[model samples]
Target chain A: MPVETIDRSATDMKAEAAQVSADIDAFFDGLLTPVQDGRERLFAAMRHAALGGGKRLRPLLTVAASRLFAIDRDRALRVGGAIEAIHVYSLIHDDLPCMDDAELRRGKPTVHTVFGEADAVLAGDSLHALAFEILADPATHEDPWVRSDLVLELARAAGTSGMAGGQMMDLAAEGQALDLPAITRLQQLKTGALIEYAVEAACIMAKLPADARTPYRGYARNVGLAFQIADDLIDHNGDTAAAGKPTGRDAEAGKATFVSLLGEDRARQQAQMLIEQAIEHLADHGDEADLLRGIAQYAVARNH
Target chain B: MPVETIDRSATDMKAEAAQVSADIDAFFDGLLTPVQDGRERLFAAMRHAALGGGKRLRPLLTVAASRLFAIDRDRALRVGGAIEAIHVYSLIHDDLPCMDDAELRRGKPTVHTVFGEADAVLAGDSLHALAFEILADPATHEDPWVRSDLVLELARAAGTSGMAGGQMMDLAAEGQALDLPAITRLQQLKTGALIEYAVEAACIMAKLPADARTPYRGYARNVGLAFQIADDLIDHNGDTAAAGKPTGRDAEAGKATFVSLLGEDRARQQAQMLIEQAIEHLADHGDEADLLRGIAQYAVARNH
Candidate 1:
């Protein structure tokens, strides 16, 4: 990889990170209002699952990428918020007792642990619907074409061949030996699809045509791989306190991951290489790509 | 109510319903092909859950209503297919052990029973995503506005205050005492919302203005109510075999339903009255609405 890294101080990164949580948190807080009717519990569970906690990594990536096109601030937050909603809903479902059966998330009780299985399921489902709702609404983008593409792309990303399909693959792979290619395909479907959506959303919002999107697509592809490797590394050897739930879930489940296949040193090097290449994909852009470049670094650094 | 019934022979209703099942079944068959990969289980589960059975009432209603405007047959089937997908996915979730805890649907084993809980849940999520994907595809409609509207309305109808929200209410209402008004509200959200969407999709495709939709809206509202009453009546006195799944679940769960609150005689009367009124809303239309009229009667008469 070429040495094309852009230098930014820690303060710059910190400032860029500040509003993502606040903005997305506020977006969900407003969207999921409380009710006095029988459905109040559902909304409350949705609020609890969607509003608080987590790194907000997917939305943050979207927001950082949006700066590349100088997209409208409100539109950026809404797009980013919808992406975050999809990510959070996936987490809630993945943590169900019938699924991962975990009790902790973001260092706190999982939605199923706190709200019970029925509410957890409904809450995840409600968030799933709401993500498309936000994207389809005219407020997300004045152009219905953009809104339609966002809905189509997000649905594709999260559907059978996308994140949801990847989840099915992950479950079926339990207690089985998966080679590197199979593991890569699984991770690409599960986590990588949504992450790629986060970056591609900016390109769509920017009105870039299909042919013009190769560079951004390449950028998103690299970022997704790097981000997945970082996650495997975190689950491999990171501190429980920093990692939230636990370390070594992949090993505990006997599931093969990038770290399990490649080892930690190689995984770290692979993630770095992907990040540099991801940054290189944006070589034509000027400093508008700073936050995006910074994000490629942060996705690996925070987890590596 | 003034008599406005369209006298369609039983053979006509049967023939219309025949193609609907075949069409939508083929749609899912094509959408969810078998896979040799790890994700095969997930797609198989989704296929099991989505294809092969049920009343196909929602999709049938969309088809019957589409006749009112002579909507492009292919467009109507796709829209109807998407709505059916949403309905089936909802049923899969509702039948989970944590929710309704049923063992049979369309006289076949539930998805969870056959595929395990994780696969079942993921299948439901995949179908839910597929519904939006189908709607957002340009092939669904040449106009992005039409596609966007369909996506928006479907998402709204399925989201927090739509069909999913109603599911939450139904779960919360178990063993509780709900009055007539409260029960009506619950039924409206739980089942009525999607039924309305099934009818409204036609008007949307026709590009009817908001004010011009009053009659159609009135027709859908009545049909939705009549449909819920019929469902309650089925659960109240329906034979197990004809109903596919066992009947009397509401009574067994001690859930308040229209039949429980209104008595079978009154509930039956109310459904007939609503169906008649629903038919009356179509008085201005010619023979084009005959199939829709038949559906209104079928929704109420099937159980009553």
Candidate 2:
């Protein structure tokens, strides 16, 4: 695309992401409305954790990928909402006392800090259950096969060999020297797995051809790695206020991160390179994939 | 049925339960075998939590229910294994420091006590994910609709409105005096929900007529309540060694339970009444449901 067209699409992508964020918020609010005899405290904590705030980038990726195939935007958003719930739940549990022990997230007190540890744990567990519930619902997709496919893929992405395994690796990585290959594999499993699922879910919804899925998968892989590298950079140099959490946590913990292993300049250069390659994977889709392409740029470009 | 037939079936039921327990253990072991370069710690913790000795009553219930419609035994076992995973995950999380702070389970060291709290949490979380994955796989059911239905029901049973919500209520009830209705509702949500799903899943697998489901639902509801009441009674009067964990914990915590509210004699009577009523719900099913009837009796009759 031309320079002017690229800039316009970037603006469009931002607006589109904002719309998805609002839609998902409303969806959760309705889903979690407290009945007279409901567990109000648990619901309140879930709302507090889920609705507090984030970029909603994963949902954006789902929506963007769905748009590439002219699939229903509303369906994509609801599925995206499920993905966001899984993401938020992971964050809640990761911040617990036994884990990272983070007190603040998204510029506010973490769920365990505000809701008490038990409630926080239950809330996170409930959110994880809710994600599968949403995906399995008929409203998410008219075809049962699609819903089942989404559930299977999402479960794999979230389970032992994927994000959870990555987390275990991270805990083990503390104070241990990890090579570049190990760190890369760790990041791929920890965060990349879910991001890849976000895009994959859209393809499933669209019933895209298997051949057509390759580019999107390649795109998602590169974008995910780039996003993590950018995150490491932010932790290394970004302000705590801007990042919405304490910075330099990797250094403080002596954790083996990409920045720690490769140095800041090389890490930045690699992230930029990955983003470029991610955009290149979208070459065949023309203007229809502009939002996804824009997201690739935004992944490494964002300060936070 | 004749008295002789009933006596013979009860013996058969014990043997059946034992077989189901062994089948589920093998199923879990096969499901959790570490892949090349897999996260061994997480897998080990999951195996520890899941494989430790228990009655495996939930899987037995599922198997017994499925047998009513002459459903495939292997298929039922796989679904039962998924249910067991969910049950084990709940126990693991409930035993975490932030929750029950339990040191022992099934007469063995708890997951957190053996593998550290972080691994325990991830194992529980990953097990939750694995439950849905198992259900969604084509191996669980040939029809995607059936798989989707199973996932949907299990998620609801495990989510905020079910097990997690009940947990929240239990936490909130710590110091508060709860009446009979509140306690009943709590138990129904926490334990009854999953038991209901266990029977309901078999119905889905069998494609049972809609009206045929009512009796099983009634049977499960009564059995669930009876099971909890029995648990409360055991905590009130049984030996800690036999129970495999601390006994009289409800009294120690001053948490209101059926035993505390109804007194020991009345509580025992209540459980017996529920078990009898539970058996009556299966009156129309003949000897095919004998195992389920035996399970109801065993729920209140067991020492542990």
Q: lDDT of each prediction vs. the true structure? A: 0.86, 0.90
Q: What is candidate 1's lDDT per residue for A71-169, written digit by digit as tens?
A: 877888899888888888999999998999887788878899888999999999999999999998988898989999999999999998899989989
lDDT tens string, model 2, A140-209?
9989999999999999999987899899888877788889999999998999999999999999998877
Task: DockQ for every model, please.
Answer: 0.89, 0.78
Q: What is the TM-score (0 to 1) of candidate 1?
A: 0.97
> Clashing pairs in model 1?
none
Displacement of the residue B183 alpha carbon in candidate 1, Å = 0.8
Q: What's each prediction's clash count?
A: 0, 0
Model 2, B99-194: lDDT tens digits are 999998899999999999989999999999999999999999999999999999999999987899888889888899999999999999999999
Model 2 chain B: which ten-residue window has the lowest total lDDT? Answer: B31-40
What DockQ would you assign to candidate 2? 0.78
Model 1 lDDT at residue A231:
85
Tell me how candidate 1 scores on lDDT. Answer: 0.86
List of clashing residue pairs for candidate 2: none
